[model samples]
Target: MKKIRKKAFEPIDKEEKELMESIERDEWRPVKNIDQEKKKAMAAARNTLRKDKRINLRLTQKDYHQIQIKAIEEGIPYQTLISSIVHKYLNGSLTPRS
Candidate 1:
């Protein structure tokens, strides 16, 4: 009759198991620089206070080209000219006479 040998069972080590458990329970916190956060918040607040207004108007391509040409001739920006025109109209400097 042949004798059968039993295999030895090894238990898990306590220190290694606790280390893994600690790693699993670790919480992740975002790393943020205080100065960067402050700058971002300030920029956001400024943008919120600075509103962009737009208007829709119809103009011929030739008229737009002419305005651009005139602005270039006067060494001024087209949008600056438009803003000045609008301001003048609002302040009664430019009046329409019929």
Candidate 2:
């Protein structure tokens, strides 16, 4: 015997509604090799996080001190904080102060 499952509620937003409709239409496909796909994804993530290069950056005394203070407050190294700032700015996720 087959059991029928009921949807609890309607999608709340356009993206959610579209996703639900797509699922109903069977537009999504399952990955063929789950293990292989998982390995590839893990490798890609490791490569993304690998920091393989170093460069010299000269900062003024005041600016460097402030960055160190912020890093300490965040409980991360100042270099990591600087790297994060650069990454966020490059990805358009960091906004400039008006």
Candidate 3:
């Protein structure tokens, strides 16, 4: 058993004070079945991933090098950059001015 100290006055912000008051009043409680809820969320995410399709494409050396450099600057794999560009173009959101 741990012994807690009671203070006459302690300065805390509104959110912290509210949280402490709720804890002191036993207003907070744990979920009855947390594992089941987490499993459901994981299953939903897996289902979304499973719907994705894979594709392969051949590119010229110049185009591939440019794509690789651009992908490096964007901090993503070249394949992922290509996928994002294709997706954006298909959705009519990627507009090339030049």
Q: What is the TM-score of each candidate against the true structure?
A: 0.42, 0.73, 0.47
lDDT to native, each model? 0.77, 0.97, 0.88
lDDT winner between candidates 1 and 3: 3
Which 10 consecutive residues of model 1 have the lowest summed lDDT?
A: 3-12
**Residue 52 error, candidate 3, Å:** 3.1
lDDT of 2: 0.97
> Which one is best on lDDT?
2
Task: Estimate candidate 1's alpha-carbon lDDT, on a 0 to 1 scale.
Answer: 0.77
Native-to-model Cα distance after best TM-score fit, residue 66 in candidate 1, in Å: 1.5
Of 2 and 3, which scores higher on lDDT? 2
RMSD of 3: 9.3
**Can you write out model 1's per-residue Cα lDDT over 24-94, one digit (the tens) per residue?**
57844555797898999999999966638877767799988898998898899977777777788998999
TM-score top scorer: 2
